[model samples]
Target chain A: MDIKLDQILFQVLNFGVVFGAIVFLVYKPVIKVLDERAKKIHDADRAAEESLKEKDAIDELKKKEKVRAEKESAKMMEKAREQATELKKELTEKARAEIKLDKEKAMKSWELEKKGEHAAMRKEFVDAVYAVTEKVVGKAVDKKAHAGLIDKGLKELAQAM
Target chain B: MSAIQISISAEPIFHLGQFVVTNSMFTSVLVTALLIVFAVCANRAVTSTSKNSRFRILVEFIIESLQNLTTGVVGTGKRAHLFGPLIVSFFIFILVNNWAGLIPGVGSIGIWEHHGEENIFVPYFRAGTADLNMTIALALISVVLTQVFGYSFQKLKYFSKFINFSNPLNFFVGVLELVLEVAKIVSFAFRLFGNIFAGEVLLTVMTALVPLIIPMPFYGMELFVGFIQALVFSMLSLVFFNMATIGHGEEH
Candidate 1:
């Protein structure tokens, strides 16, 4: 085959044009899109990772708050128990003191009643004896002298009974 | 039926001033226009908002595959990106041109012209790589671009690869290397041209022998050969480029 210099030159120039057009039209634009897609994916992954970390931190804070609340409530319950015990003991002691006072008042009233009864009994006995002596020996003794001796004897007898 | 007539050179179809436009050149121009149109459409599809269409996906797939093929040889860096389009262009350009002649009407539909007593047929389109001129041009471009890449990477130090003068044996080896570089042009041109032209001749002969079902297998073979030649040309170019652009003493 005959190799023509002109034809070769023509081809070389033709290829140069084709190469330039293809680069401008196809290669550059496609590569840019691909690069942009890759960048978007990378950014999305990073955002997901950061959000996950934030969620973890929030979860940790919630856990700490719950634990602290539980501890505070427990302390309040313990304090409530202590106060309840103190109230119960104070009420018991106050009730015992009131009962003791009531018993002393009842004892004092019973002794007064017993003293009145005894006096009554002594008077009755003196009257009975005076009547019997009068019937046996009429108007033998003075009433005032006998009255004083009889009162003295009756008081001793009543005290002895 | 008449005997098969195969010409070694592509027949001249028309003239432009003093310049002769051969059939292969016309077909090359057609291939160029087709590629440009395809690129524009692909570019439009990619830049548009709705790129999930099947056509767009296909376009993207093709470009990605070409990009992957390129990066495999040149590795992923500024150099790979820089040289990727040019290398892929070689594959597209050669492959389409190689297949263009195999079309039904391309070589068969032609005008008969008088040359003395006999009439010679002049076709309107021939495979671009079937022409020796086109292959030589492509080879020269590949080799020359390799040198340019080498210079860009190594500055003046790249010449040492073929011009060493330190010792007698080293000088001889350097001279041999320089000769090999020049020989590469001849080898590249002949190899592609020989394969395509022979395939053309073979198909023509086969069609003449049996016009119907006999040449079908030959057509399939030609298609495979076309793809293979395209791959070989582009891959060799890529290898040379890779070799040239690396540091002088650095291992690949």
Candidate 2:
């Protein structure tokens, strides 16, 4: 086999040129593309995770607000029930006082009417008695005797008083 | 007697200022120019946004596969990145050189040289790796680059692999390591040259014997051998690089 220095040198130079060109034109660019792709994927993952966290935070806030709203509604409902109870009690007391005043006024009116009726009946009875006495006296005795009896009764009553 | 003849050395085709250019050198130049053109085209085809073309896809596939292969051999971190491009380029160059011999006109078209009333045929093109000079140059580059990687990564610790003087046993071991390091260049050069040259000779013999239909299997075998030899050469370099990057005893 022939070993020539010139051929070895030329081959070395050729290889060096090939190595440099391939590394520059092919290797670097491919690696750069791969790295950029990896970085993009990493960024996307991070963004998705951040969005998920934000969504969870918003959900928690909504839950808290819902709970607060429910609590306020319950409190308002309780207050309204208490106010209704107080209003019902006030109305019942006013109704009872009005019924008591009506009953007292009716009792007083009834007493007055009974007194008037008794007075009228007494007057009638008295009138009838006087008429009967006058008739009997007129029929049985003289008018002068009747008048003397009446004066004698009057004098007795006065003495007894 | 067979009329076919094979030369062991790359035949000189022309001279430029006392510099002789061989048929293998011509092939190497052609391969290099083709690779450069391909690189430019592939670079243009690959864009960040989209890679839909078949050429782009094929180039991307090859780059990814080579990257993965280098990572597998050296490991998956910094050293892989450092040595990946070199090893991949070696593989591509060697594989192309090996396969370039399979072209129809390469071995068939030649100039006939007359020697004492006998006509001897000389081919115009031969595979680059079949030349001992080219393989030797590639081996030198690989061995030297391994040292460069070792020094760049391990710094002062790299010399400890060959300069241990604390004990006689360790010193002898270090000497042995140094000798083996030099031996790796010989092994690398001879292994590639032997395989490719033997393949070329085998094909020549087959073609001479049968002339047709019978050399097909040898051609197929040469193709397989070319691919495997390329893989083997690059893998060995990768292993040596990996060994260089780590501490001496730390290598498993």
Candidate 3:
């Protein structure tokens, strides 16, 4: 029936001390470990996801590089083909010019050879006529015969012209 | 004309340190002893093979019920095994204590004492749970035990909660958490004290006003209230233990 405020306060303080001590010693640790375990798992999962994303990004970059390399190789091959075609055309042009020069030289040489053959044939004709005059005459004549022969050569030359 | 004064006196049955040890206390002690004996003898006879024994059945029922309850609340099988025994013991002991008060003449009988012109019937036997001191003691024990188990389970990391002074906001939050810890103790003590004390007062008033069959309904209500108070006390203790063992981020 006689409840004292001081006694109640004392009991409250006592309980608070006891409760605080136990909480500090016990409850906090248990809950801390539980939270730590949960957080660790969460962090690990996040790390794994990040790593997977990184790997995927690397893979995508690699794919892009491969595609780019293929395109670059195709462009280079096309340029090489174009250069080869140009080189082939230029070489053909040079060869054609050399062949034309050789043909012109051969034609000039043939013309000179024909002119020489004509000169030789004219000389042979003159020599034949002279031998025939000597045989026909069949005389051991001297200046008269030669003068006659010259006069005859002159006539024949005039007639032939 | 004559002036007459009458006096009546009653003798106390037992005494301890200026305080009378009553029948209710006797019942509490008996029940507590019986529970201990049952536990010891049952433990002695217990084997993995003894499945059908009555004591084993009783214990198993209690354990299984606690296990089921905790597991349902906590959503973990591991914690059920660890915290089950305390919860079960608290439930059974408080249940027994609450019910023990309901026995006839527990808080009813008293030693009638006269002082001056007043006759006060001081009760020799008051229900232990009905007393604020006993309920508060039990609540303190429960709350303290919860903290102890929580610390043991959490280990060194438990101190980080209070000692973390990294940021001003965090420091304030930690202080708030400390305040909450004190609040938890208060809540535990007051919840039990309020319920049990109210029940006792209610029963006393009912009986004082109506001495016959009128108090019967109230008595039955008291029995239900007693059971509910015990259940609530034990359940709250169990919940507090569960809460203590689980930190801020730890929930199902």
Ordered from best to worst lDDT, the candidate numbers read 2, 1, 3
Q: By TM-score, highest first, what's the ranking? A: 1, 2, 3
Candidate 2: clashing pairs of residues:
none
Q: Chain A TM-scores, one per candidate?
A: 0.47, 0.45, 0.47
Report the error of model 3 at residue B33, Å. 2.6
Candidate 1, backbone clash total: 0
Query: Residue-wise lDDT of candidate 1 within A89-119, one digit each (tens)?
Result: 9988998988888887887887787777766
Give DockQ: model 2.
0.51
**How well docked is model 3, in DockQ terms?**
0.01
Q: Across residues B136-225, which tens digit of lDDT does each residue of candidate 3 receive?
A: 556667767777867886876665676678999888887887777777766765666566556666666666766688878877887787
Off by over 4 Å in 3: A1-161, B1-27, B37-59, B75-78, B115-117
Query: What local lDDT does model 1 show for residue B170?
Result: 81
DockQ of each: 0.51, 0.51, 0.01
Better of 1 and 3 by DockQ: 1
lDDT string, candidate 3, A1-161, tens digits: 22333333433443343334323332333334445757999999999999999999999999999999999999999999999999999999999999999999999999999889866865676567667766897844454546666657756875888
Q: How much is the lDDT of residue B52 in candidate 2?
A: 70
Evaluate model 3: give its lDDT. 0.63
Docking outcome class, model 2: medium
Chain A TM-score of candidate 2 vs. true chain A:
0.45
